[model samples]
Target: MVDVQGTVTDGFEPVRDAFAENFARRGERGAAVALYRDGRKVVDLWAGTKDADAPGDGPSAPWERGTAQIVRSATKGVAAAVPLLLHQRGLVDLDAPVGTYWPEFKAAGKERVLVRHLLAHRAGLPALDTPLTPAEAVDGVSGPRALAAQAPAWEPGTDHGYHAQTYSWLIGELVERITGRSAGRWIAEEIAGPLGLDLWIGLPESERHRPGRISDVEPPADPAAPGLRMRPRKAVTDAYDDPASLTRRAFAAISPAADENAPAWRAAELPASAGIATAEGLARFYASLIGDVDGHRRLFAPATLTLARTEESAGPDRVLIVNTRFGLGYMLHGPASPLLGPGSFGHPGRGGSLAFADPESGISFGYVTNGMQKNVTADPRAQALVRGVARALAG
Candidate 1:
């Protein structure tokens, strides 16, 4: 407990303790967690170092209020909202074929893929037959062009896989094709700006230099950090190591994975990943998804909210090699990525970040950390804080 800062409404002291325990017992380098109940923020706490990459444990900036970090795949939840919002406004049709918007997607036997199928991870186009280099991925045209011409691994909409990296183009191109604007610009003007959230899909240069900004993520200093999951390790490792495994190909769609800390990756908008936000912004964004935030109206209407949390896919995930559940773009509370019980829908960044909203309990939560971990989902530190929130509610 290196002096956790920020308020945690009287009942939420447990959550603050949980945040502290992450640093003390879980090898956390720097992190923040926030919570909103109904429409009000009940917790906002941060601790540990801000410059996680600073050499040799030398003196570095303290993690302070307004610290933000890239939430990796958690960007899916935010990106999912873009299409959903468009549908809500009658600009996009979920049931229609994605080719209705992006004609190029009609090639390679994918003309039948529905818009909802993309969101539900059932487009059957998870891995690229030919992978892109890191530079080619952010080059704007290569990713989408490769996906449009490549046939689905499985018949379109016949099965589901995590989509992994290909999801960037699946959704990004669709958004751009329909809105006549970059997905990043649409998000900023439509969702982030109106909601007054400090979230960004494409981070700007000014945010890069700010004090306490989560510009980079770093590995845990400790040798024995928590790993990918609680399981017999060999099986998972084999799946990841197999050259032809969906797990391998899907994750490696962009070989070597782009340097997420680099300025170029931050500037390019990749909807399936590469979104950044503070714990407060992440929590508040999800809070607004399910209900109003502060005085602003909620992003999703009641019917749209129902559609979002409704389970669209479940069972052994093709890429993850685990039982996972999804509701459109958001991950549902499930065996693989349990959140706060049923109806909790959100996404977790493979690195250390988690955010979700439980419409059933009227709770929205976020945890952002510079200490990247191997755990893809249900990260122990985040799970501990989620438990604390559940405890606070019970108390």
Candidate 2:
């Protein structure tokens, strides 16, 4: 049995069991799960080794409470909050054309793309025609510049698709253009700083040692293999198998993908993919979105929260090739990836990290892992934990 540590409140012990089962049965390398109810943390648990495959050790370092991991696209939820907070404060108009703030966005028949369109992934600029090198992606200016000059793959506001990597630059540039502050800086000063969370969009050199090194898990040898954890839907499989498909292009927009475990990638701000945080920190951040946490101010007012959670787009995502649902900037609960409940809103990382807030139950959850599975949506381990949470709430 994995030596799991930490505590869960009286009613939340089941969540700890589910977390332990992940290491015992689901091949979890290193991971942590945290949950908050109302304003208080109810469950905080972590287990396994930081690097299961590291050399010269009987086992890798113990997974400590302070250890964090890079939560790929799960970073989108935190990044989204920046613009949404600005909107709540009356600094941004969601319905306004993006050109109102970033004039360069007016080119390439994108003049009609509204701020909401960008948030909803309906702006039709999911991928860049010109691919960006890892260095260019890290530089910040090059990726957004390429996006500004390229035409949308589809008509603006006509259809929705997962922006994948482009969502970072699109939203990041918008935040900078409107507030004259980088999204990372704004998030640090306005959100993490106030809540006292360890989350970081642009990690500092001083804290580089805290994150666990990431390693990819191999997929099942046969695509048709039964009971495969990372099985893709038929539509998803068909789209991904085609090299020229929008789904493939959108995910590969950042060519020569940056080494996620590298110091440079962790220090640079890639709001969609490179957020580094402890599961507790991510849980606290989401908890604050729905209600005050430990006397810290709530991030979103009720009306703004409603707007952010409302379903803005739902249908076949042109890029993901799955029926994905998106709110203003969050991935909502759906058949594709049911997080906590119907009222839950959050984003999942490309591999295994998942986080969300369920206002109906007054619960917020965060899970991060260093052992990444090939699954794109809900990893089986996370799904098990959510099921445990549901069972706990039901009781």
Candidate 3:
């Protein structure tokens, strides 16, 4: 195992093995994992090189360091949290019609859609029917405005489908309409700011140098490669492998740009997919749900937290093609869930980054890696760390 350094108040040493195995698998690239319990920082560790160009930093390079890479869809969970928090304060209503807040959304038979449907990934605007470039996707006003005009793929709440890339803009517009501030600013001023979390819905240019430079993983040369064909049509072909296609458009920070680490990309703030955060900040955010950090509580009420962990949709997600279940704003432990445990509720980004909370056990975990893996969830490397954390927590 690559050298690791961190404290485990509960004395779970296996957590070290989790990091070791993944680093070994990645040839010693840089990554970080953090855990919080009862609102206190319990596990904060880092290792390897942050960038491939400047390797050989050794184990002492600083586990507590590194910038947020695009956590992909993990941003959805963070993005979902904004509306939920607002709902709690009567600033927004979960059961009320989404168009009630964002009138423009009513244009496409979305008048009956509720806020919960959007959070649950059932709003049905998965891929924008209108093709947009990376620049158009994140050019501030254009992305959300275009989404507001798009039509739903399925009936609002009839079936669940992962919104894929469109979720943030769809929900972001509602957030802006309701709070009068873009989701990014609101998250920064309300959630990240108060909690002292380094997470960002939109990244700022000043911190660009801090982020670990993410190199997109090259897809399998042969479609027959193991794991390459898992869901080749949807996950591979439709999402990442095409040149100048939707997947490329999806990655470009310009046309509905969801580029995980760009400055203009970070500034747009599509909570569903573009969240940037370090493992430390992510863990602390989750820890706040079960326990408060320095007297700060930035999530649902403890009871509401309990409510969120309860499964909402647990079957074939029309979009993801897996039996994914969702909690209020998090992913519930289900057959398709990576961590595969009852108490956990969180989401994994498209390329392997993840963050979640296990409220029943008062455990919060975060994993961030620069190396992008093709698998969306149940990633062996990420699961190893989670399993280690679980073993540590239980011990």
Candidate 4:
């Protein structure tokens, strides 16, 4: 039996049970789950070995409270927050053309693309026609230049699609153009440092030893195939399976993908995909978004928070080929990735990691795993824990 450790408020023991059951039934490696309610930490639990294959017969290093994991696309939520916070501070206007801030974005007939279009995935700049090497991508050298020169896959704001890797460079460059600070640096100074969250877009060399090694798990059987809980529409499955589809191209924007666990990758700032954080860190960050955490500070005002969560796009996604919904910069609760309630908003990583805040329930949740299950939107393990959270709240 795996030994799960941490505290849960009196009524939330079910969350701990679900966390352990993930190890027994869902094959979880090192992982953690945390929750905050009304700005107070309610549940914080972690279990399993940090280095599952640690050398000899000696005991493996346990997953520690400080251990962080690379949360692939879940980083999108954090990155999105940077710009939204700036918008709240009157630094950027959502309705203004992105070219207003970054003049070069006016190239390729993209002069009218609004800042909100980028946040809501309606800019239609999903895949780059020119592929970038992993090294050039990590060094922040090629992605922005290539994207600015390429035309959109569809008319900007006419359709919505997941930008995948392109989102990092697009938003990061926007932040840099406006603030004269890289998104990572601005986040460190304004968000993470103020909140004291152990999250990083561009991790420092000194923190290199903190992240656990990530390993991929076999993907779940196709949902469109027989014996699945939910069958996808033909268009959804077709787009994902075709190598030449926009869906595939967007995800593969970085050709010969960079090694995610490498020191170089961690040290670079890929705002959309390469964020590092512990489950607690993610939960606390979300908690701050919805309300105050530890009397430290709240990131969004009520008006700005409302705008951030308002649905900007809802329909078939050109790249994902599924009916998806998005807010200003976060994934809304929907068929693609459901969180606590209709009011819940957040992003899920390409793998199993997920973090969200439910304004209705005053719940902020985060879950991270070193063992990655290949579910694009919802991972079953995280879903199970979410169910446990629902049950606890209901009781």
Which candidate comes out best when scored by TM-score?
Answer: 1
Clashes (candidate 4): 0
Candidate 3 local lDDT, 1-395, one digit each (tens): 56675655558567777787788774446677888877878778877655433445553233346445567778887787778778778788788888888887788788888888888877866666566776777666776777678777678888876666777677788888888888888888988888888888877766665434332222212111123333444654443455444334333323433334446665667677667788888888888766778887546886667657777677766645556888777888765566637888998876567888877677888887766665655656777888887777667
Q: All models: lDDT?
A: 0.85, 0.85, 0.69, 0.85
Better candidate by TM-score, 1 or 3: 1
lDDT of 1 at 355: 92
Q: After best superposition, candidate 2 residue 370: deviation in angstroms?
A: 0.8
> What are the per-residue Cα lDDT tens digits for candidate 1 across 96-191?
998899888899899899999999999999899899998998888999999889898888676778987888888999999999887888989988
Candidate 3 global lDDT: 0.69
Ranking by TM-score: 1, 2, 4, 3
TM-score of candidate 2 relative to the true fold: 0.94
lDDT of 1 at 76: 88
Count of clashes, each model? 0, 0, 11, 0
TM per candidate = 0.95, 0.94, 0.85, 0.94
Shift in Å, residue 72, candidate 4: 0.7
Once fitted onto the true fold, the runs of candidate 2 whose alpha carbons sit more than 4 angstroms away are 56-58, 209-232
The alpha-carbon deviation from the true structure for residue 307 of candidate 3, after best TM-score superposition, in angstroms, is 3.9
**Per-residue lDDT over 1-395 for candidate 2, one digit per residue giving the tens place of the 0 to 100 score:** 88999998998878988999998899888899999999899999988777645668465677888778888889999999998999999999999999999999899898999999999999998888878888999797997898889899999888899998898899999999999999988999999988888899998776775344332222211122122223365766777677688877888787766677678888888888889888999999999999999988789999889977899999788886667789999999986677887889999887788999999999999999887776677778889999999989987
Q: Considering summed lDDT, which 10 consecutive residues are worst modelled in model 4? A: 220-229
**Number of clashing residue pairs, candidate 2:** 0
